[model samples]
Target: MQIKALALALLGAASMAGAQETASTAMPDDMPPPPMAAMLRPPRPDSARPPEPPRENIAAPSRAVALIAAEAALAQCARDAHEVGVAVSDAGGHLLLGMTMDGARPGRIYSGSRKNAAAVAFAMPTSAVQARLQQGDAAMAARVKPWMVVFPGAVPLMAGDRLVGAIGVSGATAQQDEVCAAAGAAAVKGRL
Candidate 1:
């Protein structure tokens, strides 16, 4: 009986020693590493780009050519319908030129200018878009209606697959507005 008790005590001590060894040194090899996000963070929301940049060979019309066309278009529009409002924007929707007629009402300039922006943004004629919506196809036009004028006289300025800019002319009949926009686009075609 004394031998059995000693054996049991030795067994218990062996188990205790094994448990301590496991607690002190054993590692779980199957455990997965932490997620990458938890390990490292990305750049801040407002970080500037690098100093050295590679030049891209994006062949587009010159700003001078676009301005010259815009000027001629405005001149032609003034001759035919008098000055109204003309807005011009670059391909990415940046306004490069904005003008209101000598005696135009307030907000007319913005409305007219945005009309051209709408045309370029949608890559379609505003008149056509209006006609589509008028015919109950507002599904597509609705998407761009938020940022563009549905009324006539806005035209997209395209330079091949690239859109160069847009021209919006307003302050007259829809037809007159369209004609004015058309004239401006025609003047810029050389640049496009």
Candidate 2:
């Protein structure tokens, strides 16, 4: 009888220990498994992080320079007896100033803005882009965006050899517009 009691007590203790071990190791049914990539990656040390890259200092036109350019273009158009719209844009192709003469068409303002965008995008005068397109340069034509105007009405503003911005003119003949835009860009050449 004593031997049998001892055997029964040992069996009960073993079963309880087995049940506790299973309960501790088993996962809950509602819990999701860890991601494979996260589990595969080893822990990183604080000193192992990569250094940040240096930032570039981009150039752009100031508001005062943009206004001066726009006003100069409008004055040039007036002197030539042409009612026109003019737009000035920063190096980032953002419109800084836009103006139209009293007799200018409403759409001319938008045209001027598009022309400015094209000059800024090409980093040259829109006339140059037009010339390249005319020469059967399919690659250059493909680079033109829908909002860009590849007309002869825009010029890139330069400060010494660096492009700072662009000026565009509309509501007149293409040649006249180009003349006005050139005057505007030239106005701020040294100041920019």
Candidate 3:
């Protein structure tokens, strides 16, 4: 019995060794390495790019405009005796500026970011988002998404009919937050 067991163990060892060799050599033996030029080629020329239908140009708000809007929101919040946090984002939902008052709660910072995201996502005021959410369960279901704040604390920063960006305020009552955000949006209106 011992002799039979020893023979089985040896066979198993031989099988494992064969498996390791096969695994190690399988790829390199079956295929050549990729050419260096293929791996490190420059980007395709513009003409080589896939043809796409022409689309209207998009104009995102500048950093300077975002800063002006954020500052205006914070100033309005302060004037209303509301210590608040503010965030501004460009049309592409890129954060341009963020500010927080000395006494503002830490959560307000996150709330402000969410409000900004919500405004840019919907391309409208967050108050309108709130109204849409209240319209029906399906609207609320479709509207309540991750990282969204469907509340009254943000408004689009519009330059004429185009949505340039958005400004959001938090750390106050919903009405007060809306007031601050509106003030911020007003500051950047018609400035393009």
Top lDDT hit: 2
Q: 1-192 in candidate 2: lDDT tens per residue?
A: 799666666666666566555553332221333333333458678788678678445567888888888899999999999999998877766677889999998888778878877888788888899999999999988878766788899999888878787899999998899999999988888899
Q: Rank the candidates by lDDT, best first.
A: 2, 3, 1
**Candidate 2 Cα lDDT to native:** 0.81
Model 2 residue 63 lDDT score: 86
Q: What pairs collide in candidate 1?
A: none
Candidate 1, residues 92-131: lDDT per residue as tens digits?
Answer: 5456677776776677667766676567657777898788
Model 3, runs deviating above 4 Å: 1-58, 137-140
Question: If ranked by TM-score, best first, what sequence of candidates would result?
Answer: 2, 3, 1
Tens digit per residue, CA lDDT, model 3, 12-40:
66666665665642321233333333334
lDDT of 3 at 25: 29
> Worst lDDT window (10 residues) for model 2?
25-34
Which clashing pairs does model 2 show? none
